[model samples]
Target: MTERACILDTAPDAVGGALPAPAAPAVSSPESAAPAAPRRDMPRERLRTAGASALSDVELLAILLGFGLPGHDVFEVARTLLAQFGSLRAMLDAPPEEFEALRGIGPAKAAMLQAVTELARRALAQALDDKPLVDSPGAVEDYLRLLIGGRPHEVFVCLFLDARHRLIRLEESSRGSLTRMAVYPREIVRRALTLNAASLIVAHNHPSGAVQPSASDRRLTRVLRETLALVEVQLIDHLVIGTRDTFSFARHGWS
Candidate 1:
């Protein structure tokens, strides 16, 4: 007999009757699987294609944060931050301790946020240094707001300008209690002379969020203007920065 016929004739239990039927594959439930979010809708991708300026404040923040905590998504974390602080500026200006207290913000994230604001401030300062202030009054106002608008105390700053009205230096001349500050016109004149500045723009902040200049503010402006004029240095403007607005003496004809 053929070898195949001899094996069929032997019906021994020892010989494994027949190979067990192939086992069925496991089936996973649809409810257990989550679809991945589309890449195009992600913040980083949107920023890359549409540009940073096109992104919302929360989106930019999400990029910085990189990821969210265990139960929150990155966008949700960013939204929580903004909602708690009220705005991006408030969040950035928040104290380190306070910032780190927020959910998903640790020392590293807080430091990153602080560094971004500082870089922006430095960039504005460098831009002022590169061009004449007269040509970029709006930039001057923005720089001043960023520097002092959020301070908790009064701060007097001076932007010393060269003959061409380019910024020579920016100085914080005085800091005082929350409600009051004293500025000296004579000392301002002395500094102008020392810096060989041909013009100056003076500014101060009101922690109370009032952009209106006080009687004392006007008096100081007049004194400084006359004092600088005696030495042929012009008083270009006096700006008062408040939380939500800024007062421009030039705009109001006070300078």
Candidate 2:
């Protein structure tokens, strides 16, 4: 017999001829073999196409984080951070040790977050350099909020303005315990003299989230205003920064 005929004759199934064409190699369905879908809608892609403003706060944060940990996606990590801290501002304001303690955030990620907040603070400072405070009251309020709105303790900041009412310097003149801060008008007046500031805007945060000024707040404002006027410096406004809104003395006709 020919070679092929010999092989066919030798090979057999239980009751049949050759082994039924080897059962055609058991191919799997396409769905069973398909690879995972690609991640095409990442924050970077959306940011490039639609601009940074289009992204949600979490998305912006995910981009900053760059990548995820072994078991979590970057979005999940960012969401966890926000949920833990309660908001982006709170997260950014977190101390290095506290921030690093989060699940997927190590020293590097914590440093990155802190650096971002610092950059924002510096940018606001730069924006105020030659811009008149009266012309950009909104910017002043926003900068003040970013500076001390989330602090656990009370902080008093001063923005000293030149003759044209442009920002000359920003100083955190005092910081106190969670509920109280002692602000001295003599020291403030001396600092204004040292800077040769023609005008000033004073701000302090209310950790209690109340925008209404207390009696002590009003008294301090009056004292600072009178002390500053002694040296020809104008106290343009006294702003009380609360969690939700700012109380402006100028807006209320108190300045």
Give candidates' CA RMSD values in order.
29.6, 27.4
RMSD of 1: 29.6
Query: After superposition, which runs of candidate 1 have C-alpha atoms over 4 Å from their true positions?
Result: 1-41, 69-72
* Local accuracy of candidate 2 as per-residue lDDT tens digits, 14-113: 1222111112223468877533222314668889999999988777888888776666677768878877777777789899988756788888889888
| Local distance difference test values of all predictions, in order | 0.76, 0.76
Clashing pairs in 2: none
Residues 47-148, model 1: lDDT tens digits: 888899998787788788877666666766787788777667777878888876677777888888899889989898877886989899888888888889
TM-score of predicted model 2? 0.79
Q: After superposition, which runs of candidate 2 have C-alpha atoms over 4 Å from their true positions?
A: 1-40
Clashing pairs in 1: none
